[model samples]
Target chain A: MTGGTAARGPLDGLVERVRRDPGAIGALFPAVGRTVGRGPGPSGDPDGILGPTVQDEARAALVSALAAALGDGAPDRLAEEVEALYRFGDAEEKRAVLRSLPVLPDGDAASRLTAGLLADALRGNDPRLIAAALGTPAAAALDDHAWRHGVLKCLFSDVPLDAVHGLGDRADAELGRMAAGYAAEREAAGRSVPDDARRLLSLTHGETEA
Target chain B: MRIFDPHVHMTSRTTDDYRRMYDAGVRALVEPAFWLGQPRTNPGSFHDYFDGLIGWERFRASRFGIRHHCAIALNPKEANDPRCAEVLRTLPRYLAKDGVVAVGEVGFDAMTADEEKAFAHQLSLAAEHGLPVLVHTPHRDKAAGTRRTLELVAASGIPPERVLVDHLNETTVDMVDDSGCTLGFSIYPDTKMEPERMVRILQRRGLDRVVVNSAADWGHSDPLATARTGEAMLRSGFTRDDVDRVLWRNPVEFFARSGRLLLQELAPYSGGAFAGNSILRAQHAEPDA
Candidate 1:
């Protein structure tokens, strides 16, 4: 099971296991963090593993089990539960909840109900929460103003721009202006500007002033 | 320069913060449970948080060679909510857990009757659990809150020495010192008590029952505030032993009442997973073309 090629299968098995024992789903969700180890596995053998951690996969499986348990009849309640889990959860649990948002069974209704959470996360200084909030379908819930600030927060927290979902499609002239202003402030403060600032500035496609 | 931060929320912090803390000579710390920025509506929610404090958080800190211990309580703000009342019943189980050095952060948030009730109740819980108590004074109306807090401690029949009244400023310091309880000052970068202010207080009051900490949490705070205070003490002509006494021994003495401090040197954490969770992100090298 420690072999890299078997990584995807175990994750699938976990989902099926939870689905089969719906009675045990409640116990299993929280246990996912403990049961499936988050260590390096052979899955990303060519160079290295670049995607979600094993714990991430486990959390997603648990959320899927939850969605399956509800069986599309209670999308509103599912959204409510997920939001409560996020709000009351620790940073790790909150991050997991945010990561699983786009995959919620009824995508639109669940997204609408929990959209406010993204903004709350954006306002915090935690890089993990900020990065998770900008991951799309979650990012889609934010309007232009909130989205730009979320990207700015990523830069401020040193969260890589690549963590952001759909950065290419969403980066606009105002975002470029904000990035440029941030760059200027960094320069004035005698701090080195981050590479993401340069990337966001370029995304403006000359719409922003020099 | 070994330090014991008596009140930092390591659960909200990152691994980089831990590495930095270790570098700054922070060898041990206590994380008292407090409000998580948002309100908790259910009692069951507190269980998971408490579990994390005793379980995963302790493991995470061990990985960085910092001894992590926690205090379990229904924080003062949460006491006002009836939904959280049930947590009081479940706290004893957590209080009994190893690595739980104290029963804390249990004091006035709004100075409401509900707050007072929980404060008084947890005081007895601390006595019952044979653990030291960490008390949080209300941020607003702190002097009065400190007065009432001392009053409640006096009423609870717990020894004054075993109770730590935290977040004290200039106005409330003399009173807490007079109360025979341990004085806990949370030094911050901007607000609350500054490191210089902390130095003056130590110089005047002497470090008999004083324990200084960073008390860094979710708000705008610095985890190195405790170390910074130690530096300020040295700059003010205090000796090295004085810094160690206040920064390390003071906290150890206060929480040592629990008989549960994990001060023993831990084997360096080699990225081992705790309960299957590594608390680190996935990383795989790129394939050579």
Candidate 2:
């Protein structure tokens, strides 16, 4: 949940299920194990179109997998619980979760936590998620995220021409056109965007796409 | 969590500025004495401005448990005022005083000869005190000016690790990195680097020796700029380690190099003795959480 990569092993997958799913959510130290075959089930859509029960089922699956892995022998169960909540529980629970992650550091743990948080940060301009990711991710994970595709290509890659990735080309030559439209809309309402933004000089305009 | 902004100015901000920053996660900010939007008059105004950075503003931040730190300097923008420049001779004395961290936000604003001259003097002071220098570059013709600033830093013989090239834009980061100094990018709202753009740039440059700042002063800036950059980096699919390097370890290392205060388990503090103090009473308090 804190900004760091958290490797969710098959064992961890089971524990996540036990914690959240009433089916497994309330298990009293249930014995679980990883078959080592399947990857994580779908995270399920974040939009909440999935009903509450379905969400709980998915959570239970995650909890079950988690319990099977670590076996609850580890101390600091509260911290682990908080980290899970911070990562998967809800938006508001992150801050409380982050305050605890800094105290515990294990191998590949921070990075695993970081990957999920970084994904969250990349999704929006949220501060809490940013702080957690900033505080927790493993060094290598941080390096990977910091120097991502387009940027990585421009700064470190041997070929500057092929650095672009992720950003889709929904519309080519659309920036200038859309910028003009935006400018026109603003003028109609007697408003203004900064000159650079109005002129399509925004950094987002890049090589292509609106 | 407690935060010390390490850079900001409140003279040009409104009450809303304080409120929003407080809410957005800024617990403390360091205001380096610098040039205002325009020129200034007698020492009294300058005194008040410095006062705000260390006095009024300090109180304001502490109200939110944000400890305020001040870096007194003759902003490069005002270096042209020979009468004001005369004050430079006295700045070092203040630089040696309490709450002063690495004679800065002093650097080339217009990249004017006067700015260069002032920068040299400040650098000398930083070296003299074993303090790190926080260098602010100009906003226009930035790449050239950043290069120039680096050239002069080497010319002045200031150690690269002891300098933080601030206000960096995408065009200028290379110059900053090449200088072997730490980079400080300001994610100003609507004015400077946008959050998304910052993520893009970070992706290109590693977080090993760089930091992100809001530089939110009189303009429309977000005090939570660093955090915003963190978020954008994640959306860009970066992992957690990347965000931590840039926001936490990097800045912590920079401040340690600044030869300022040492902090451990520090959190935000919004109250205490941030008012008119006995000059003799000035003492570094351990950072609190």
Candidate 3:
């Protein structure tokens, strides 16, 4: 077990159990939900209508367990389960699935399978989900044009620049040109561009200069 | 609605955040010494961070017309690091400074033995200095951590009223509430508590001894969370006086026990540089005549 999974306590054991018995996915939901709901306060709702942070953490653990449990199947079957989870899950569950894309079984192939979901998330305005999608390991699978659009979408929706993964490393001349164009448009419209845009532009400029 | 954010980290925020917070009626705030996103290798890094909190950050906030005070401590997360144990000895001098308000962000993170020791030691520091404390409850096991925090504070002989157990939610507020310690809620964009949820908490618990803060840091958070909460309260039929008590006066009264909260009236920041040098560039600009 890695250090990160070891820290999650019972969820780690449950993951192993589910790996042996795939039918345990049914039992996994209530267990994870109960864990999420166990912390203090009014506890009548076992489904755990908790804060986003706690929910996100719990959901991420559950998704990891699911992905690991399904790892024995063929790559296509694993992808199907992941897609089903993303499609059938609630907002928090969907976010967890989206975030787990990078760690899912087939690496780049698995990430590519979720292209529709990623594109949809980019088009949507839920910053939390958008950030999760953008920061995921799967985001590296995006083509340059889609990646540039994702960057611009973050700016347009007021999401923090920190949400974008590998921002400094990913900067390129095309991104810089796009940022310059965005800056000029903002100026022409008697508006100011975001500080992050300037930062992105500067990083891209540095890379180009190098 | 002059808000006093009893616990926030301005070190991670930009000057634009300060200006926006000031415009949203944040006249004063306390930047509690907490863990930066990354761990520091030694005690010297902590000293430098503490100095920045009390020195350059204060100066920077003043330029935006906000009063900045700080709470110094060895954060709970760092307490486990043997290298950071030296910080416990150096906290006193910083605690005695003029703008130092309380000892805080100093409770349980992982609830480890070292964290307990650091927490107890800091509580004693608060008692010795006659300062208030801002306790950060562990996010993972908050109810148990909060219970342990109250017990430790009680064992240390620090009065419950002198401590503010922060990062509370619906589950933990009753414990802090019944304990007679001040309650702190950190309103965030997606985590912690939301504006409507906070308003509901206030409605259920009443507004006495409660303080709201943005607790904005190097994460996905909102600097305007306090202001947004105030707006939510008004829209939910809370009186203006109730908003004052929760958002402003509660924090003022809580930290006032330190005898270091100097609530001065600062002039609104007109567009100009700090000592004739703007953040944009280093060259001094002539005063407009």
Whose TM-score is greatest here? 1
CA lDDT, candidate 2, residue B189: 64
**Which sections of candidate 1 miss by over 4 Å?**
A1-210, B280-289
Flag the better candidate by TM-score, 2 or 3: 3
* lDDT rank order: 1, 3, 2
Candidate 1 residue-wise lDDT, B1-289, digit = tens: 9999999999889888998999899989999998787666779889999998998999999988999999999998778667777899999889999999999899986566778888889999999989999999865445667899999999999999999999887778889998899999998654467888889989888989899988888778999999999999999999999999999998899999899987997765555677666655455222321
Per-chain TM-score, chain A, candidate 1: 0.80
State chain A's TM-score for model 3. Answer: 0.74
Report the C-alpha lDDT of model 2 over A38-98, residue by residue, as the tens digit. 2222333222111111222333344334444444454345335535565444432343233
Q: Judged by DockQ cut-offs, is candidate 3 incorrect, acceptable, medium or high?
A: incorrect
lDDT of 3 at A101: 71
Question: Clash number for every model?
Answer: 8, 72, 2
Cα deviation of B199, candidate 3, in Å: 1.0
lDDT pick, better of 2 and 3: 3
Candidate 1 lDDT score at position B7: 94
Error of 1 at B211 (Å): 0.6
Cα shift from native, residue B53, model 1 (Å): 0.1
Which stretches of model 3 miss by more than 4 angstroms? A1-210, B270-289
TM-scores for all candidates: the values are 0.59, 0.53, 0.58
TM-score, A chain, model 2: 0.29
* C-alpha RMSD of candidate 2: 22.5
Candidate 3 residue lDDT tens string, A1-210: 111112366656666766777556554644554553333122222222221344445555665666766664556666776666666665666666676676666654475667856765654456656776787567877777668767766666566777677877787887777677657645533457778888878888784322
Candidate 1 chain B worst ten-residue window by lDDT:
B280-289
Individual DockQ of the candidates? 0.02, 0.01, 0.02
